[model samples]
Target chain A: MLSPILEFFSSDPKDKKLKKAVEHIIGQKPSNIMLYRLAFMHSSVSKETVAKGYKESNERLEFLGDSVLGMITAEYLFKKFPFKDEGFLTEIRSRMVSRESLNGVARKIGLDKLVEYDGNRRTVLARTSMYGDALEALIGAIYLDKGFQFTRKFIVKSILTQHFDIDTVVSNNPNFKSLVIEWAQREGKQIRFDISEEGAKHNKEFTATIYVDDDSFAVGQGYSKKKAEQTAAMKACEKLEIS
Target chain B: MLSPILEFFSSDPKDKKLKKAVEHIIGQKPSNIMLYRLAFMHSSVSKETVAKGYKESNERLEFLGDSVLGMITAEYLFKKFPFKDEGFLTEIRSRMVSRESLNGVARKIGLDKLVEYDGNRRTVLARTSMYGDALEALIGAIYLDKGFQFTRKFIVKSILTQHFDIDTVVSNNPNFKSLVIEWAQREGKQIRFDISEEGAKHNKEFTATIYVDDDSFAVGQGYSKKKAEQTAAMKACEKLEIS
Candidate 1:
């Protein structure tokens, strides 16, 4: 086990830039570099797996890593704010794990150089989620290769402790849905969110409108209905000066 | 480290019902009974922690275990349905992890006997989600006691392989929101979901309605807007005979 782990990490003893960088980023020597290799494999390339019936992409790992990341962050917040209710914890969690937030964090951690997407990396459109997905895949790879405790430690030492300020995150209010509803109730007005799917199957966009007393107050769009509703609520809050 | 692990598992030389049941369920000697103790602790009896200003409940563990469970299931589904898209994967996952399903699985696995919630176990109203939360806590405990590999094996062998039929879960469409929208679109009818908050801050209930061509068609309620939308969609589907 030791021999294979070391050999895999030191395969290119002459030039181990990827391995060295990965080790530095994750704060440990790589056990199975192949997992890390797959972490860098973007869906665009979608390289075929050595396993006969498998296609290798970071998507599955991304999905896994997403949950891992959420758990770590949830644990952190749960400990830091012991008195905070579930709603507050959940809202802050959303802000911390949002695509925009993750994208920014990925860039801050210099994941742009490590990703393997099959497109120009410099385009503004491509930059929308440039390294966010790869970062998640890396977390998944680390979880798979290192285990949960090690992954949790990496999230704490490498990501949270080093990259993010937990205090700022906890202090901010991100639950616009609650805010708009509260405003509506206080003013004795009824508010409703009308959400509908409006796009292609794979890239479906949901449109949500915040309706005040059967009239449209604000409109917002997102990849999912919940996301669209949140955006729409934020827009309504802003429009009504309640934000 | 090995000695300490062994000692922790074997410390309680007496009433080892918890340890025995856990060992039997997990198919291995638990490394830490303390973790299992925390797993059985419901919020009603939230024991204070040794850590200053910290309270111990199964909540944090539940949060962690949820991610562990999600990751394991996601990996399983990803492998099983390599051709399926993200939407399909997400829909199938919901069915597998729904409260109703979890509750049933928990009862089937005898978590009812192991859980330590401070309530009458015979009450039907209290049975709404008695064992599901404890089941998650148990998974979290197993993860903490034996680590991710052990947890993964336990989920696969003890839970999925022994308990659930993956084929049935995959084949059934659980995303009523999607189904209702599809049916409405095929019929050229304008469909909308009106989601609004109702009730107290802590005991908040969300109400959702399915509107077809500006007419109220169905109503559903849940703890969150997304769940409310889903319930409303399911009701609409049933009402229109599209489900």
Candidate 2:
């Protein structure tokens, strides 16, 4: 029962280019045809087939893949940076899992080669998050077909260790919010955040004040509290001349 | 610095009787300090840590964990239930990660034992999503502390396999949206979703109609697409006696 369904989704074995690409990227012959199919299935096809009580898209797979990626990424960070605390680990994980990074990885893996679409190029172009979404879906599919261990190995070897630097990436990107608070407490100062007004309602602005005991030493404003604090901290760092 | 901090968080080692209860329920030693902390870090923590230099709480962690939990749960369903398709996998994952399920886990693990606040308990009670939020944060922390294999082992062995069955869950809790769409299409129907009026400009009410070709089978209303669809779908489901 599953054989013909698998055959329907699988690329022809004779398609040398796709086969080679799959072999190079996945490092083995494809065993799970439905996963590959789900990775490339578009929502339009899903909508049509959904009416027939037959699911036809990668959305579910994408949802599954997202978790797998996060778990694998978290695990990798845990072992790689044992000395770092939870806050430090979290910042690094955020950068690694950010939409920009995920999209970059998807493009590097030549995922564009496998995309099956039925619309104008503009339509595909408009759906920018498609790459990241599909990549996540593919990871979900891989985990389903193979297993957690295999998925973790594939993610570590293919994505984390290969494409990104562990230390340089994290250390350079310290959490500004944490730094600002640390500096305030160390100098025996009080800090105030006034999110009174800035930006539109959807994008509000915040202003932060760093006071050394009784006097305000620095002030900064930005779209988010973290950004505002970073600005304020950078200003205070200059005034304190701690470096 | 780190040792003292660890001691401060983990001292008392979770009361012996309570620990035994948690072991019987969650089936593991507390995975890591951050997981325990996150389970208690309420949004009321004001988003700024004097030591950490930021005003953000575990909200971001909760966001990341929510998506990650969804993905991993979906993959678990996919592998465990080979006969089940995308819809079934989605339904099972939804149930596993639902607010109620997460709250049940949180209560079982004695998350309330670690809260650090002195506000009206009713205010805390109102935010039902907090339970799921804490659960996700715990997962995120575990992934950071333990790594992929251990985290996977913990989640699968401790949570899903121990507490629930995938097939029964999916068969019982069919997604209302999917069911409605399937039924509408089978009966040769068209659905129209219209935003009739918005409340306060910020909060909006949407109306959705499930039409059998041209005849309206069901009409429902809500504040968001998902909510509106669920309402419409529920109406259609009850009308058709599908479940």
Candidate 3:
């Protein structure tokens, strides 16, 4: 059933420069061939050519892979940092999976070299974060070809443990929301942000106060109550640091 | 770490009568132990006991498992019904993963008999649907413990291939949102819901209209515009019988 799709990979000969570049980036020989093809398949390529009758582009795989990546990352962070609370875990994962980080990885991996497109000039802007998404789609393919355990190991060994520093990265770039949530949880606190007045109907300003076990910690204002609380909580964290 | 947890499982054992009844229903010995256990762990259980100090609940795992399940089911449906389009593939997947269908599976497996509780019986309703969530959680656990290949095989053999009659099921159950989206995609339709209306400043009512190549297919009303559009889309699907 997948023979035609498999043929697409073998028929398209890899350029020497592209192969070396991919080897340097991926840190391993491309074990599963389908993933490499998927990484290069731009939406610009006619969908009919990619899969026999698959209608949508790699968007669905990207979505699926994004969630898978998230789960594996979350689990990794959870086990790695045993003492870290949910807020900390969430922040770290967010940082790891953020568009900026993924794009950086994509660029580092030189994914831009492998992408197949119709026009060279027009495809310049196409190389941006779409490469990161393509990278994830490739990961999804690897996961399908090789099992999850192998994929998980490959992700950690090849990507995270090899390229990134876990502790320094997390400690230096703390998520404000996570810090506040962790502090609250640690102190057995209950915080609520009540928007007493929104200045305008269309574009409203919200006032939020952080409560630690019903006592007000700090108050802040923002366009949204969530933002306001986050600001308030950040201020409280600062205050606690001083105290 | 798991001894205390295992005690909870051993406390009730499986009610002999219920076991016999389930065996009669399933026509086989339930080989998947972790899956059954996962189907029983309600969110109500203290987070400390589940993963130890981490608030690592089943929610994240459920989210990941849901996507995996969705993709696998879509692939199955796509191959099984070669004549069906993208819309048909999507609707069948939705039907397979719907909360109601999962809940039904939970009932069939007698998962309700295995749940551990602290006996907060008054406010919280302990229904079989919770088992569906646990089922997803268990898949997460299996992915962790066994691997994705095992999980995939378990799902295919135990659930999809054996239990579900795909043709009859898909023909009977049609997902409205999926139908509308597919129809829009195929017809080269551009649809947007104009939600400019603001009611009583704070409160808002949104009206949504479905446009198929600039023609309105249906109109829907709701508290939020996104909701309204979804409702309208659903209505359009019903009217057109797009599924």
Return the TM-score for each candidate structure.
Answer: 0.63, 0.54, 0.57
Interface RMSDs of the predictions, in order, are 5.8, 9.1, 8.1
Angstrom error of the Cα, residue A15, model 3: value is 5.7
lDDT order, best first, reads: 1, 2, 3
lDDT of each: 0.73, 0.63, 0.60
Q: What lDDT tens digits, residue by residue, belong to model 2 across residues B8-89?
A: 4555655444445434544566545544454457655433334443444455455545655665566677667554445446
lDDT of 3 by residue, A36-139 (tens): 56556655452443444443345445554665577677667756865554445655776787776787776676666676654643554464577787777666
lDDT (Cα, tens digit) per residue for candidate 2, span A153-243: 8999999988898767766764455676777788566775443454345545577776656556677765467666777776565444332
Q: After superposition, how far is residue A176 of candidate 1 from its true place, in Å?
A: 4.5
Which ranges of candidate 2 are over 4 A from the true structure?
A1-12, A15-17, A41-51, A55-57, A74-103, A119-129, A161-243, B1-22, B28-68, B77-101, B108-110, B114-134, B137-243
Best by lDDT: 1
Q: What is the lDDT, from 0 to 100, of the residue A185 in candidate 2? A: 81
Error of 1 at B96 (Å): 2.1
Better of 1 and 2 by lDDT: 1
| Superposed model 3: Cα runs more than 4 Å off | A1-35, A47-64, A81-95, A118-128, A144-149, A168-243, B1-39, B47-95, B118-123, B126-129, B163-243
Winner of 1 and 3 under TM-score: 1
